[model samples]
Target: MFGRTKTSGKTSTTAAATTDHEVREGAKGRPTPKRREAEQRNRRPLGSPARAAAVRPGASKEEKKAAREAERKVFAEERALQRQALVTGDERYLPVRDKGVAKRFTRDYVDARRNAGELFIPVAMVILLSSLIPVAVVVRASLVALYALVLWVIVDSFLLRRKLNRITVDRFGDKATGCATYGMMRALQIRRTRLPKPQVKRGEFPV
Candidate 1:
């Protein structure tokens, strides 16, 4: 009985080979019916037509001009109707101008007062000393002081008075006028603000 019996592992391998051969034969005999059905289902629908011709390229020059003229005519007709309606209507809307003259004047007066308070004494001293001193020396000294004073005034105006005026104008002036004026003043102030600084620091150690 032991001599006649085969190994269990050899028997299992033989069985597996037979099963694989049968599967290959089955697959070759009939292409899978389900796979064919799925391919047919995935195909694009034939009902819808292709897209219309690509808008016939760009219009010719004459066609473009004609279209523009047509649009202009329509616009002109609309504008004429609007004008007629406006002319017939009794209610007229006029834009009013701002009345900031009084405010501007008052602000200028105040600024003048402040500037004079700070600057008048030094100016008076310069003038008094210039009269008592030698003419050339006095002129040189006064000119230098006056130049410094002017620079100070310009800086003060831009930083302080101009900014204050812009705020006041926006609050009190007409919207359009105030905005335009403020824009111009702001531009000018910005231009004046970017002055060159002295290169030397006052208390630096020598390299």
Candidate 2:
């Protein structure tokens, strides 16, 4: 009786193992290992190496010029629409202007106009001088002028502005004007020209 019980138990264990193997084989038919790997590859990010290789570079110079011309035409049409809306007081297109905002806008407009007029004559004179002189002479003069301007900008922007800040704090209890002056000095520095320096030879020292 003992041997017969042991043999029946071994046969049942083998049947259970066979049933588990069949379940795994059925799952393979539903979604295979290869299909899962393909799905993962398809979900890869756009900037990944594989995706980057598929993207084309930007257009050529002629194509870029054509695109720019098309954009300019669209901008002209938009400007015309805005102008028409403004003249007709179209509420849908025209935003309501606050009195304080309008005042500030007018002030800025007037200041810009006055500044441009003041600069016009000096700028015209410089352009005329540049046209009359040889390009090499003009370039040398410009480099010298640029060096001087950079030095002046460094001094006035950092030193003079700091002094102005102290004075403004002591007298007015406000530093707004000093800040504006410092900003103007910084703008001048940004607009200044940069000239290339002469390169020295391997065995030579710059004089």
| Per-residue lDDT of model 1, residues 1-207, tens digit only | 554455666687899986886787545654556977888666553311211111123666666566556666666766565554333321222112212443333323332334322454467577667756778877777778776766766675456545555655655565324433333233232221211111223333112
| Candidate 2 CA-lDDT value | 0.45
Give per-residue CA lDDT, model 2, range 103-156, as digits (tens). Answer: 222222222221222333355457556656778877677666655645654664
All predictions: root-mean-square deviation over Cα? 22.2, 17.7
TM-score (all chains, Cα) for each model: 0.27, 0.25
* Candidates' C-alpha lDDT: 0.46, 0.45
Q: Please give the range of 10 consecutive residues that has the lowest summed lDDT in model 2.
A: 190-199
Q: Pairing residues by index, what is the TM-score of model 1?
A: 0.27
Q: Which stretches of candidate 2 lie over 4 Å from their true place?
A: 1-132, 174-207
Question: Which whole-number lDDT from 0 to 100 does residue 98 have in model 1?
Answer: 15
